[model samples]
Target chain A: MRSFLSSRWGKLAIGVVLVGFAAMLPLLNIHIPGVLPGPTYTPGALSVLAYAMLIAALALSYHLIFGVAGMLSFGHAMFFAAGAYGLGILLNLLAPSGMPPEAVFLVAIVLTLVVALVLGNLVGALALRVTGISFAMVTLAFAQAANVMIRRNTGDLTGGEEGVRLEASLVPEALVGVVNTRNLYWLALGILVLVYLACVWIERSRLGHVVAAARENELRVTVLGLRPYTVRLFVFGAAAVLAAVAGIGFMLLQSSATPRISTADFTLTLLVIVVLGGVGYRWGAIVGGIVYTILDQRLAELASSSWIAELPPVLHIPLSEPLFILGMLFVLVVMFAPGGIVGISHRLTKGRGGKKDAAEPAVLQDLEA
Target chain B: MSTVLLLLITGVGLGALYFLVASGLSLIYGLMGVLNFAHGSFLTLSGFLGWEVGRRVGDGTWLGLVVGMLVGLVAGALVAAITELVFIRRLYNRHIEQVLVTVGLGLASVALFEGIWGSDPIQISVPGWLRETTEILGSHIPNDRWLLIGAAVVVLALIVLFLQRTSYGLVIRAGVENRTMVTALGIDVRRAFTIVFAIGGAAAGLGGVLASVYFGTVSAHQGTSLLIYAFIVTVIGGLGSLSGAAIASVLVAVIQQFANYYWGIGDLAIVLALAVVVLVRPTGLMGKVKH
Candidate 1:
């Protein structure tokens, strides 16, 4: 029974349920039969769903490094930004002609992967030398360096502070039109599903066990006659590429790459998402992503909307800033709900017959043993 | 020769700021194994506060410098106390939770500064004596670097003296080596932590005042950037080693100055320092080898 619950089918079943709900969210505005009104859908809601998916995909990639491998990086933004700006640079350089949007995307992705591969190898090599807090700080330092280089040196390619706009003509008509954003919505959804499955597979794999072992104690892993550095190097490179893949989706969703993508604040946002969802939980990424997007959208609305804007100065000082509110939420959630919503639910179901196997992530369970 | 000398002075001066930033961080790590991610926010907050104080004391007297430093230290100490008492003390063994909390606080503080300061950079002017240039090796350079270097060294020396010469310092050193033993000795470890945090805060505030004065401007958002530098220096200096921080700061600054001179890119120098320190000497130059 336990084996079956941990099997591929079980995970896939979970995925299907989630995807179904996600797909249905924007299509299910209705009246509950003679009782009450149901969810109201909007294109705006669809777009937000799309964004949440991208954030989930990105957060999952971070989980592989931070949660699975125990490497807390303060600069995951570098890879995300790399993936994003890599495409923008390529499209701009190869302008006025393209075989097709598909071809351009493929070629650009290939280039970005190569860039991700090299940068990942370099950063991972340096970063892997230090462990714990030092490693986190080093990643941040490199990230800042990357941000500066992108902002100052690549003015022609990146548009400096002004930010570079991806030329729309670079992609095919069906894939990207200013008004018709359904293509992006579909693209983000499909890619998010695929990447999510990849994350699940990683969590259940032997390599995942090895990564988990390394996270717990490298010296112990070494005594067991396994090469920990090779494991760290491989996971780091894969995580970097995975983050870049999400970055590609991000650029496509926005149809442009900006300096904002590379900021440390963005990485902090990703960290908050993972921590707030469920640090090691496979599906926590999606849950956290949605929660973050909704809170972000609502708070930002409250801060900028007419009522708050018109409030008196003394009364208006504290509550109107969306970022301040988000920051407070981050602190509250991490402090109060460290296990995230998933963990909270698990606690609530303590009295009932709980799905124990599903609750414990495979990697974490192995590490514990 | 003069250019090299001047560059060396500037590097040392730049490094002094790094030292100040890393002092509180290193001390915190030494006594308690927590890395304050919001250390730079303390610096930023203090810088803005110090700038306002300096502005108020527009007489350009030594009193202005004294007031600015005092204001920065007090504000930084207050904020640090709140953070330690209200937030950090609760999560003692959980380093990862502390990271997230501090990072959140870091962002919140930056946003708060933005709300108050309105995204504009504030300019700072030092006393005339501090700003006056002097001829050194036939090169004319402002005395601001000297003041920065002087102030940083003095603060670091005072901290070393306090730790070495005082009972509290002895307790902190003992605590760093083994907290259990320190706790067994009945030295309320938590209160000691608060004191350390306050000291760290004051040091960060001092860094803010010195940094803004050296750069001639302070921005609400500079904390995030400065935090990166301080973290790197602390890591490369080997966690909890004050001397390591000072040396690493100078090494980082000199490399940056040289990198700028040759490649017209200074940030790359710091990146290179990180790479070298990580790959070649992960324990840092002065750091003892440890697991």
Candidate 2:
């Protein structure tokens, strides 16, 4: 534990500081003037914060698979949704009305993780048989298929197009006074910290090195006598669990699970977050999630306003607020900052020591050279 | 049995449409190793163009097709050129970057279409001659379906002939086999890429025309919905192999039609069926890459 803290204490310290800041955000919101005069302590903002953290967690999971394992899964959302619905089903069946909302939420997270493990095994088993673009396509196919199935078949439990709503009992009474949003935000922050620590721990573990090596060259790992497939499957499962936990956080915040959870928009947004934050770099997902959520919320507000809608026909581009901005950002990032925000930060901080930043520089050099 | 036959016919028609769209995607992927995610957007845009042309040209089906194809060709060239200059030029060797930039372009195209066309789904009527249904083997099939199938066959034959008989096709094939070798031999590979990209775009545009006629509706979201299936078809048939993509298109279409017919659940079963196939055959049936 001492060695772990000393080696990467910077990341852990940052995580603590971020969580502390997040905890204070709700308190700060109360003091801010002219924000919105409803509740001095709003649950909605907390819910949004929770959802953002959940997204960050999912993005981080994708980073592990894409960055460390070198597996570009277009369908990782499959696991995420599955894990969420898995919890949704359990809560609906078991808790019904007796269990507290917080307990139900906790139970859901566990159930989701288990479901992810099973799904990870199945998908990984099949995906490991392939490499490169083929693997990506296969994963995408599975995710798309799963999305369709979930949206169609389990309508009764999932609430179909209407979405499954949480019973009032599912929310903790303790949270009722605090405003459900604040409770959720705190909960999300707690989960995010735990998950981030887990990811960091995994990154520093021996298995993590094996996974990274497998990403570098599967054949070389195979020659080294390690079962690259097993390493990939384990990491994929772990990543799925992380994503599922995030999904649970999302459900708690939204108080429901809709077919929109599986929409192309959601998948695309997640991809944007991952790319915007930088694919593999540590803390990239968290940074990306914050930027994306803030932009999205602000853009929606701007688009809905009367002044923007009243603009001249030729000069006005409708729905050009968030999506256009995001699209342009994506293009610019791919063209210039291929490493993403976190990647750029790493480079800046590394300065002369950046020679140790191995694989990414080599990949970028290949692009530039 | 009648239902089965009906499904089969309908499947073949849809498959033909998918073939028109996916052929370009497969070709582009083969030569350039870049998946043109915006292919579906091109199709949707062309469909809208066809609708506009039909409305303006007093309901002439041939004129609509001509205008749609012309617009598609121009749009295709523009998109290909822009993508080449902006994204593809930077991501020549990086597969992930290629995927990311194309996806970004796809999103931008979708947003642009939404901005122009609004968020609603627009219905595009078929021409008078193509509106009637014909009875074949005790099953009623739409005339437009038959026309689309015929068009697909013609397109397929033309593509085969062009690839087999033409010098440019030979060069493309050679380039696909080995880009470095072709470039080393002094062929302007960039020019070849531009042509390939344009051709791919044209195919997508033509597909839009067919889709508008068949679905009777066009929407900004249509491109994304169709893209997944097209990607699946290309992957299942083997990426970069025209024959494989064509065959896979038919297979996917037939399966989807049957699933929709018998299962009656929706598009999900068809997607699941495709996933099953992928799980079993990661490299697809005709993929050159060994899994």
Candidate 3:
């Protein structure tokens, strides 16, 4: 049984089952109190689920850069904004150019991907010049610049602080409106699966090994005639492009893109999600994304609940703030729970064997090098 | 020509604000190698409390403003020192974890601030003199610009004096150069870390008060927005050098002001400048570390 579970066919079968189960969730009447607002089949729950999946996909891409490449980037949200805004603007711009709605949708996706690709390369090429903290800082500067540009609404492109909405005329019919929430949910799921598979393929490839090695020790990789810079740049760009893909899904699911998506705080929240889930594990990101979304939503509800409203100021204030709770949870996780949720689970289920695999992400310390 | 004069002085005034925040960042990163994301929270908290105390003391009076500045300074130092002692000290030698802790603190503190003060920017009352304009070279510059510049100059002088004159400053300078060597000398370096945190926090706090005066409002997110520019300045100035920060602050702010005035690309210009600097000299203009 153990061998079967580890076999390629077995793993593929498990993945199929998991995806099938998730896909059927919106069609079922299952309820998870405190986590879901209503039954699973409801539009509200489906919307939340879809949002979580997109976030998970984004976090997975971040894992490729941070977990796999050991790059501490505080600016990953720019590419996300790029994907979201890119699609939003492209759809609105092209909708009036005598293109059919279907054609416009297809063309807009392609253009947004293209824009994201170019942006990823441009940012990677420049930011890759410096290593470690400087790299992080440079990326941050670029993201901040992008944020300012969006907020300024120059030429009336970004809609300033108001942000741009998804052009309803341009999007496909099946992906629009509350009644079609399940379609959007499936789209987000597809994106998550696609991003996850891409991340797996990259990790299992020779380039991934090289990138991982460079993370471990750059000098050793350099001694092997490998250009760690090029490899890292490729990973960074790929991650950025993937983040953009998630952004597109995000735009579709929400039916609008906001300036808030472009902010540094958004990127920090992504960081929080990744760390909360687990640093190096792929499933961790997915789980972290879903869990964080649910907690965030539910906590907001809980804050406004009647019983909690009666609490004293000290208890009431901290409990009422979702981000404060999440942030404190994150700090505690970093300090005590090194491997995050995945690590804890591994330790609980597998005992001695899991202990070795569950060690704290050594990449965290190596970031200084 | 008058426009040029106005932009130049205004740029310097803005640069002074940037320097106030960047100076401590430089010192802390130089000595401790930790990028304190919570530094912005310190500024935000101090800004709120400073305004609170200032209003209660004498609202719109110079006396209130002075008291507010003092409260900001103490609040900053105390909060920073406590953070170092409680959270950062526990994660010694773990740079990434230290940073993550700060990130978490930054997020939590901002939320807490919002909880306390609400999310909106509170209009602050300042002395009437601050609202007036001074004519310099036929250019009308806001009176607050002089206050900002003067306060920043005094801060820079005091920090320089402290670094050069005090024994702790001597240790801090040496520690920045080679922390291991200082540790090998049997000196207690953790104390230095706390001191640096306090000093950095104090500067940021002072900046928070001045920032309220400049913007005429205090908001939970004000520190965060300004923190980004300060981060830019800190990087351009070469992470650990005081003089580098001072020079880069003025240079970046002036360039930003000019670009904003001429082409409306101030933030982009600053970003481009950072990119150019990193490409040309990755260590920064006066950066000591070879990154």
TM-score of chain B of each: 0.95, 0.91, 0.99
Model 1 misplaced stretches (Cα beyond 4 Å) = A1-11, A24-43, A96-102, A309-315, A357-369, B59-61, B129-131, B184-186, B289-291
The superposed Cα distance between candidate 2 and the true structure at residue B36, in angstroms, equals: 1.8
Among the numbered candidates, top DockQ falls to 3
Give the TM-score comparing model 3 with the true structure, all chains together: 0.98
DockQ of each: 0.51, 0.50, 0.76
Candidate 1 chain A: 10-residue stretch with minimal lDDT: A360-369
lDDT (0-100) at residue A278 of candidate 1? Answer: 75
TM-score of each: 0.91, 0.91, 0.98
What lDDT tens digits, residue by residue, belong to model 2 across residues B1-291?
767788889899999888988888888888877777778777877777767766677554667666765665566556666667667876777766887788887887788788888879987655677777788888888888887788788878987887889878887888777777888998877777777877777777777777877877788887788888888899889888899988999998998887777767546665565566677776677876321
| DockQ-sorted candidate list, best first | 3, 1, 2
Best by TM-score: 3
lDDT by residue (A302-346, candidate 1, tens digit) is: 676688868886546446666777787879977787767777776
- Most accurate candidate by lDDT: 3
Q: Give the C-alpha interface root-mean-square deviation per candidate.
A: 4.2, 4.3, 1.3
Residue A265 lDDT (model 3): 90
Q: Write the per-residue lDDT of candidate 2 for residues A1-369, one digit (tens) a residue.
A: 434543657556865787788788777745433223233357655565567788888788877787677777787887677766776677777675566667766776676677788888888788667767767767777777677766665546776677676554665565434455677778788778877877888888999999887776667899999998888888888888887877776766666677777665566677888788877775777889877876777676777778878888544574555687688788788778877888787777567554246235222222211
